[model samples]
Target chain A: MADRAAVPQAPELTARRRSGLPRAASPAVVLAMLAIATLAAVVLFMTLDLRGNLGYVLPRRAVKVAAMLLVAVAVGLSTLMFQTVTANRILTPSIMGFDSLYLFIQTALVFAVGGSTLATAPVVGKFAAEVLLMVLFSGLLYRWLFTGGARSLHLMLLVGIVLGTLFRGGSSLLQRLMDPSEYIILQDLFFASFNQVDPALLWASAAVVGAIAAAAWRLRHTLDVLALGRDTAVNLGVDHRRVVSWVLLMCSVLVAVSTALVGPVTFFGLLVVSLGYQLCREYSHRWLLPIVGLLGAVALIGGQLVLEQVFGFDTALSIIIEFAGGILFLFLLLKGSLK
Target chain B: MIRLSGVCKSYGTARVVDQVSAEIPSEGVTSIIGPNGAGKSTLLSLISRLQPMDAGSVAVGGLDVAATGSRELARTMAILRQENHLTMRLKVRDLVAFGRFPHSGGRPTAEDRGHIEYALEQLDLLTLADRFVDELSGGQRQRAFIAMVLAQDTGYLLLDEPLNNLDMKHSVEMMRLLRRLADELGKTVVVVIHDINFASCYSDTILAMRGGRLLHQGTPGQIMQPEVLREVYDIDIRIEEIDGNRIGVYFA
Candidate 1:
């Protein structure tokens, strides 16, 4: 009695699954490939120039590698988690103005107390202040504006962009008025330099980043549901607002550590996570977090190696990453895949 | 059983759901019918806690939706809205597997897989279970979503306009499915439906809502009268009894 003729014959799903290569290889296999890529980058970064004193140079390079990994984990996890909570693929946690916020904080410090004291001040105090402010700024934004729905997500993004513009605009104004010598000092702080990273702050950053990564891992299941949108997630009985707040807080810490380490590198997360999503076809964050983090590590280490070895340190690595990431942004926009 | 007491919601100046209070009985197919801007969807949203209430509370099966743990509430009740847009590409089977999340927490056990398989067959989607949801037609996608909710295996199911993109055959198939869910499975099915005749034919009880308040809630036979239909829709509708089901003809 039913009209069977109207049913569009869906392609034979059984046949397709049998032949699907993406599904045929388990997510673990993909992760192994990413792991191998990371190991190759590490080996190349370590022994490419074997002439330097193994004792001094290897440890220093090892420290740089570790710093890069910390940033990679922070950026990768934060961006993916942020996209999950906001239910959009194109957005990054940096859009929350954390980058500009960091800039504003540094510029304000230099503007208030002069750059010399800041450079000489106890490293612990300055580092703690920056990290704390990042946490506070993200918490304030999440509390004041981010309310766990599509309307709120858009409004938050708009407010963040506006706030970012204001922060950067204000910093620029201060820089213009600053003494020439002090402006140079502030400029040094602004341009991300992977060439020289302070060894003292590395341990603290690892502790903090490690803690946040653990927290994110614990909530990976919740993030998977949150990505399903507010309605479906709430129906599934997820405490949407609470989970979002935790995620925002975690993102704040992650972004703070990364920005604090290497200044601010925008769009790096987008490139890494976008590639992760493409490579790893699963929705569960358990598989996604590691995949994205490892991908980020490979990108950072490989790019730095090329800049140092191939290009003779003539250019900063962030510039190349930013350019490629910018192109990816435009491509994603033109493709209209982001919703 | 779902109980709503003094439930109200407002958007800016307009009160979308105004102190709506009703006790929906368990174990039957119930359809909410109303004209546009009538607060039918808003009421459902409030009850499901998808949208917060300005001044009210909803309790499902004696558990306070506001106070209950999210996973616990999810285990008790499931609600599906009309529109679903996903940012991630997902296979139909994976999407349906998410229904077991409230139970399995993303790890699918053999039992969860059984539910997923059963839901697929129930919705006539076993053949297309491996297909991507986005690749399917609108009606097939709707069925896929329905299958996901059904796989949740909750005691109570709240659906808002589940038939939005379906043609006549699929719409009838959906209604019959819900009818079986209520009659055979003894699940409490609450649906927001636009078709008055379908509401009368498939639902054991039909609730009439207009202007953010419940106008009437009764058996299909009681709500099928021309006077009640006019009060709810603001239009004259002639009703006829066919095969022991009330059918409303609104055509001139």
Candidate 2:
């Protein structure tokens, strides 16, 4: 009742003018265009070189693009689905402490066994270990809460935030006590950068992201119902507990994979999903999910290209995105559009 | 019949609905009325399975609400709570189309379109079908939500304070529509209403609750007395028969 927009009178004319502007610009069309735009960005990134050393540059660029795309899909889809289940727009899956947990795991690994052990460990093995620990903690906790005690979603959200603070504090304390050389390794790993995605971990991240996307696709309709808020969803006969539990578990895995692949871009999901909402009118995930994924990919690929070619490695892509995304976040809060 | 057997719900030390055991007949309109905090809305929520009970069970059409699958229960009953809000920018038509989700699973069939049209027409909202739900006036939005529930076309409807936004004329019209829904469509409606005159004029049965317990459940003729009204509302209410309806005058 409070958030009603002051719609213009006689929307008929505005709709007619809009129709003229885009004869074939439905939400599906918008999503397809975004996909194409991302594809174009990828092509431009790959073949923009005047030297034209295709063999020398294409594989390396392709690997980077693939890693970015995987992380994009993971973050975008997880945050979108999490917002729907929580019935609010102000939150992302990062609130579940997965990002801080990622940091904590990295710090604990370094603190317990030292930096050389982690550096010496196979990339796949270390990635697998980090992802496995997060998945187990999140999945088991969700299962116990949803199936065993079956508490309220409000309670779960509060618990998640508190746990996030605890993890962050724990990691910070560990960071301060660590050896200076070990601290460097931890800092390098904790900072999110699209430039440093490991080639070895790319395949595993892709597989995990693919599995998550498929699961999300199957539950797309149910997810739309969930966006109606808990009471209405229950009124429409949704198995609220079961659906929320599964979605939370999936969000954990997605967040873990994305953070492990590209460190932690806390606001990338917010940027993509907000842009996705602005770009499309449809509420159905069929349009929204793809649009957000494509937008994320485009943003990362384009931002990286500009950073490389224009800035000449002056800064990390994550900083620019976080800065812009953080401003957008503040604007949305002030605009009271978070719901 | 909608039956509540020993149903209970509580928050902290206060019981909002305590061991509510009653059978609501599967015909006509039934009004549950009492002062604020009298468990009227909570009872409706329990019957609709919108809230889990701390103890006991509610059964509708002989199926236990706790045991029935959500999809199956949705086919049998629909509930509309007060204070409905949407985070999505949905037009009236799109919002009403969601009523058919339990049947069509988000892909509207031709028959679903028919139901949508019928609902829109019933709410006199056909002209405003394309308007965004958030753009409408309070009453219009209320009507749109009612139309969505009507589009579900379930055998039973449980509504909590549906008249919260309506004007005097619209309130009468809305009550008449519910009467027609019950008399013509053979649906059972349980409404938590505030105005006693509307209840007396429209409902076939009345359930008066007080202090989280059922104080009285009987036909309007049997339960609309000043004594029963005084007991339920904790105030002296004078009953006057006007236009063949037992109108309770509690304003004084």
Candidate 3:
């Protein structure tokens, strides 16, 4: 009777396929777009003829572009990893307050040593100190939470937000007490600026990012499983604790590297990652991760290039990017779409 | 066969699953029935090695669950919990494809696709395979998760409250599917169930637990009696035969 009528015809599969976009287009299109974006960034950065002396402008822009790309990749990958591990779409690595901790250290250093002494401090030494301190703070927090099994991801997120507030409070108090001259130096470290990057730290950051990427590539398959959440992931043969720890460690190193490189850019990763997911519908990390990495590079490099070429460097690119990203975050939050 | 020897789990000073020991039959639907907080879910978690037991050993198919490699263990046994709060927006088909992870390790082959399709068809999710899991109704989502576990195609399936959010029709479909998996495919099915009638009608055996202890274990015929039901659930349940199936009715 009704059962016979419910026997769907072959055409139904086609109807079902129409509702969702064909999976075939996702990986290929996303990869092609990423490849094109990467190529465009490199070509534009290298061969945008300008009136400035080639000797000075060429090397300087190259370093700045490299710094932006590194920050983009590192932040993008870390945010993705954070969301995967915590199993929350809206949770970013910044929710864990790594960037605020970085700020706190910078403020404390200035407060302790005074601004004059801080400026004269070797650039290499300062960068290394920042990276080391960032890693130590994140490592201690994540390792404890991951191993304890008592703290849920929600609890960790709340704790991290509170910690961030505390750090910001401490930094603000220190800033108020510090002389105006020292405040200026510390302020430069607050907003992400590509122009102020230390060339000496570039090689070290490159090595760190490469090593983390290699580690992440090895565990990419496990990350797909990890995205299924803790219990299911464990059932599916993923060593849940070990894999989560490794991912968090890699995230820590990446965050430390990027934070040290171009300073902290809070919403940049969120902007690129949300765009990456829309660009690629597939859940496979093999495609998703790299697409995210490239999208990040494109956002930074392309945005910087446009700012320089089109706008003639009237304003810093971070201000524009931060403004746009901040608005996007608010939009996502207000629309209740970040879950 | 799955065996738990003196299994005990605790959080801080409180014993959640106190020194419980039991052996589960190797095949068919074995229902662990209990009131809330009876440690049925905890026991299932320990058996599947999802949660580490404080002081006990569990073995499935002659392999020590704690000592065996997780990937190796995954090939042999699969588990489904009630809550599936996935952060990723995965299609139903893609989520089911993950069932072959233990065998294919995230690389789906032709055989994996066949398994995924079969699972989808079995759970009546073929039409909804392309839809995001979050977009489905509660029953549809439950079926989607069951499809994922069924696609795993392991020797053993441990399900914790598979019928949690399912409606009448879907719950019956789920039970029938479990029965078929056990009867036709020879899979070992262990489920933590709350509804006594579903357990009495569909399960081959019933293991009743109360106050973190194994209250009773026997064939459904033995455990479905009025007295046993009263002892386990502290409710006046009348067992009546419906088409030769013992149906327990607990309502006034």
Candidate 4:
């Protein structure tokens, strides 16, 4: 029996090899390539032009790189988890109103308490409050939708889109009514920028993202099972509802960290995750999460470098990413690959 | 043995599986048969704990399914639903390797690999082991899913419409394989099958359900009568003896 089983696999293996299609690169090789690229981008971004005082230029560059890397990890990990939980490649935490919620909170605070007082508030406290609010809102939504039983993915997506539109509309209305000076401050918060990231807020974001990353690493295997869909995962002994709830909670926290740190990034996560899926052949989260993280780092650091060096800061990195990501979204929709 | 007492399930105002109570004995092939909307699949889901009961309880191998941990229940009973759709790309070997998750927790040991190879051989899937599951034909994909459940290596197996997409040759082969697993390995196999003739020929016990209740439960000789099948299906089905096996003729 063993000999017969062994015999058939060999011919098929040889047949596949003889075929003209190029074999996929192994996950390890892909990971190594991405890691090297990310490192090169970081090095180039940090030391490409080293004129002026070393102390002033070096520390500022370090802070900017740190902020970019943090956002990359935060956005990449969160988007991957969100796609797994929702079982759709097209969905991301940002699309589900997470960034818009952050925008709404900023707008609301400016509308209610005046922009000067908000800016004067202690940075850590304000960051903590924003993080807490985002987490609580996501927690309540996940608990309500998933705890009782399995809810349709369509229903969840619908709710997310509706809420996202509501937040965006509410923020715009507030901005329309606010004082011109306050609106200017609010405008700065609307566009995602790695510059001007508070050093203290960066530390807090790192701690939160680090703790969540550690937790998510332990669930790497379970996440693979989850990608099989709810019934199959449950049959394999996964507490489907509980695991999904926890994953959503982790995604919300990661999104909160990234959004709070660098303002709202609408399609950066979508772009990173989509590219990661195309480049990596493996389905396991153990490989996928890191590949995605490295991919995000490379995209951000590399894009920022190109924008600064090649374009001379003519445009923001987020605009280019969102443009490409938005086109891909439309392509995926037209292709009907949402499955 | 799997026992259900006063198990009930409802969707809104519609009762899907109402007060279903039956004991499925171990060490044989048992088949559940009924017309559409008869709750055959729903009853199987309730027993597997894939769907929670609206009212009563289910016990599998003397363990309360609700109270036991999901992993423990998984080691004892494995179920396959009617439709299995995967959104990600996965090789056939990788899909089957998931069956070992209950035991190996995603890290397959040597023994787990042995079982996986055995299942692949049993399902005649070794030739397609390297192929992507999404690229396979419908019948081949169905067999791949069956191979996955077989690799689970549980004491009890529950399958809903396992032969839905299979051709006649593969369907008979599948039934014969299930019979051999029950007779030779002492596995308790339960299937929700649509073809009454296959159920009658292969199953030691036949359960006929109608309108969310078990209308009849007996051996093939007892439940294959035209009257019993008529009451369950709301149509006349003639039973014929062929090769000493009861076969139902429902066409025409």
Candidate 5:
């Protein structure tokens, strides 16, 4: 009974599928949606009237918008490539300790320089130092793991979790031992609040994000095959080690830009990428990457808009996002998407 | 043709493939038969460039697998390993179309589409083309992966335990298809097979291994004897000719 209706109507269904155009239609549509959402964010931030005149508000809002977009793309693209490399959707770069390393470096700076120096340090200098530390640590860790063999994946993940815990413990210890005033200064940098983004670091982060996006676009085809798992990708003539190295490097740079711009935002990458996967069911990266990038832009801008207008600035938007993302993470874990 | 010279692979203290050297024929299906833990799969992995060799070199169609560009090697050989895990949901047609990735680089032209359709039809998956691979039955999924290898349109194909989850009907169909691929298309297929009987019926050459060592390599008539199989498998086998095909019965 099922075959009879399905068989004869298969051609029509394929035709309908063509008209649907999943991969072709989604990126362009999501891009437009992102443009609208971003425009809304720009308008909302400009008119909110928290402090400052029109000239002050315009420049400040531009910096914040640029920071948000950079973080969105960086985190989004990093998580997407990370998931592809591991062949596991539930795990993110944050889970693998990149953010923790960031926290560690920040804490170490305060601990080493005796808190007062850190408080007086320029935001641009601090951000640059943090980015450099993360890039070096991640490159060393990922390069060693990827070049070695396959069994090291689980081992690397375990090591990353332990390292993250150690970093967190170390940071907390330093935080407790530091002077109270210095601790307050450090606290400002630790919390992931988009409202207090540093304007001085904007151009640097933009350049980084731009360079990384161009590099990722060049490796798009290799990334599509990489989704099939390392072995299959290698069999298909992709230089597995080289492509993976490039992708991991891109991920590190993106993570650095995002974390440097607006502190570390956990779970945002997961939320946007998952939505992107749902929107573009096809596995081709040519469509998937743009769709994910655009969806991330939309989520950030839209969430910001809702926070300003609907919440009346009463709550931190990251808290709300984390709550929902936390629930989705649990659902995905229990449902065993990785398995 | 695929050639392995003194290939050795080790994990910790244990050697998986130890000094194994062989030149695989340029045509016909060749089956590597060995018990679990024997270096059959590891050898296949090394030749396919999925695993780096610890000591030696593998060459495919005169290009050293180590030195050759992966894209160049990809146009020549395709491999399917067991336990394919997909984090993303991919339709059968889309999965098959990936075979053309090495050649077309993700943008499938009309020629690539034809290859994809032919592969799907070859595996009796034309009806299931649009179905998700993860949603298919084990046998169906196995066939889909094999079809992906065929769609690659390479001179050589390497498969690791391809019959792992396949049913009796599908397993026989798969062997027959591989045989046809070799016979009609002149594709050189090196498969790690579990069933000796299937190997005997379908393969032009058989390579037997034990404890990471190549124990024997020969044609079906030479390798299908009870004494040879008993020595290789450590199990008594009764070989009988049925309809001009050598069938090994091992239950007794």
Candidate 6:
């Protein structure tokens, strides 16, 4: 201790200089760039080769763009928050069987009621019921897993995978036993598509996603602390269990909304979040959240434009996005950067 | 000051920390030393409120740890575990800045910056503040973590095995730093240490445990004898007086 006192002190300015190492672009700049690109994609998608009845074509395109934006925000925010709470970069809500559970709920409803009644059911009532069920299920899962003794990541992954398989198996079994016509309707519901979003359902989902995003925004700083892992977050005075429960609840709602709107885009969130981390290179959620949203928007709308204009609507946007995202997932796994 | 009364913890059928009651006075270096699985770390965790006790009460500065809000307890005490595995990339300065979260709520004020700089200087990490934590060696990483806890600016500092992975020289430096913190800042520094010699040399009070119970608690001179140490560790350790500090020779 005495020897420490004898060590000569360097000037404070030099200490500051030492911290000024070269770094990636500032988070604000990256966010601006992403926002501009997203805007460009939206504009190009809306206006490319505008023709025919102005009111008809414009309203159709506007609805498609709105659906894309809502799903982008929902998926991007949910995936980022899920990864933060779980403290694993490779895991997403979809990978943990969230969408499968959603599909299970939808399939069970259709099986219980004939396809005609299910299709005739009030859209608002069905949407609310689905979102509530997803939220409740996730809340229960988080409470059981996180509140007790320490839980290993492997155990979590295994449980998620098992539950996902169970749900998928149950859905397929029900589908196999259903009427052939009903089975066709259920099959259409399973694949992700943006072509047939009901305008009323779109508005309700937007409202839900908007309210949740506002709540999540207030928790940005807490999210950053959460990314540090549970023990450290607890040491830093965070109510680890309560905050995690709330975040997980929000994630479930977001996933439900997005899956209800565009069906299950398994790898889309992974791609958006991975690209956000690579571009921003910062751990703070204040910037990462927006960057992820913009990136998701860009990928969705831009890919839609390419598919419509170049491929002449020959391929679905979700399939292409999932294909790219799945490859990135494999790349990340092979590179051993899960940490 | 930390007071424990009837503190107990167990995993399934095995009681890791039996009904252990003791008082650690404020503002000194107190080292809890014992053999492996002797419940030293468990006791520390109970006091820090890191783990819920099966049965017991811990009061720091007269505030009941269990009854108090986590944020209030955080303002009064800070604990560091042995292994800290971070999942994200963070610079040394950024990691240390997180210590201020209890006070700043993720937004650093000018006073917080002052605290951070003071902590960085005390840990001799000013030059390495820009480096990523993953880029650091084991000793450097340990120092960075200590610096983060130091920046928390709490009156009580609790560390479990602070010298677990350090070399001889780094371990000595860490012990000295703890000593200086206790002496200069008047902080109540409680450390669960494995090295009996370091405990005997640096700690003002030494608490010895064996078999999930605290066997002895006293000054270095009172607790450094061969019989007391043998009882605590189940090994014979000869105590030598070196420059008025009690040194233990345990090597056969």
**DockQ for every prediction shown:** 0.57, 0.60, 0.61, 0.65, 0.66, 0.54
Q: For residues B1-252, could you state the per-residue lDDT of candidate 6 as single tens digits? A: 899999999989999999999999999999999999999988888898888999989999999998888888889999998888777788999999999999999999999999999989988899999999989998889989989999999999999999988889879988999999899989999999998889988999999999999899999999999999888878888888989988988787
Q: Which CAPRI level is candidate 5?
A: medium
Q: What is the interface RMSD of each candidate, in Å?
A: 1.0, 0.8, 0.9, 0.7, 1.0, 0.9
Query: 3 or 6, which is superior by lDDT?
Result: 6
Error of 4 at A53 (Å): 1.5
**Candidate 1: C-alpha lDDT:** 0.87
**lDDT score, candidate 1, position A316:** 93
Error of 5 at A125 (Å): 4.9
* Chain A accuracy as TM-score for every candidate: 0.89, 0.85, 0.85, 0.89, 0.85, 0.90
Candidate achieving higher lDDT, 2 or 5: 2
Q: Chain A alone, model 1, TM-score?
A: 0.89
Model 2 misplaced regions, further than 4 Å: A1-24, A50-54, A139-163
Candidate 3, residues A1-339, lDDT tens digits: the string is 887777775469777776645343668776786789788887888788655788988888789888887888899999888777767666677767878887888899889989899788887787778777777777777766764443455577678789889889999999999999899988887777888888888888888888887777777888888888888898899888888877887887788788777778777888888787777878778987888899899888888888888998899877887798888878876777544
Tens digit per residue, CA lDDT, model 6, A31-60: 888889999998998899999998999999
Pairs in steric clash, model 3:
none
User: Candidates 3 and 4: which is better by lDDT?
Assistant: 4
Clashing pairs in 1: A237-B70
Q: What is the DockQ of candidate 1?
A: 0.57
Assign candidate 4 its CAPRI class.
Answer: medium
Tell me the deviation in Å of residue A111 in model 4: 4.4
Candidate 6 regions with alpha-carbon error over 4 angstroms: A1-23, A147-149
List model 3 lDDT by residue over B110-216, tens digit each: 99999999999999998999999999988899889889988999999999999988988889998999999999999999999999889989998899998788889
TM-score of each: 0.93, 0.92, 0.89, 0.94, 0.91, 0.94
User: Model 5: clashing residue pairs?
Assistant: A237-B70
Query: For chain B alone, what TM-score does every candidate structure achieve against the true structure?
Result: 0.98, 0.98, 0.98, 0.99, 0.98, 0.98
Candidate fnat values, all: 0.73, 0.67, 0.82, 0.76, 0.90, 0.61
DockQ of candidate 6? 0.54
Runs with alpha carbons beyond 4 Å of true place in candidate 4:
A1-23, A109-114, A146-156, A176-182
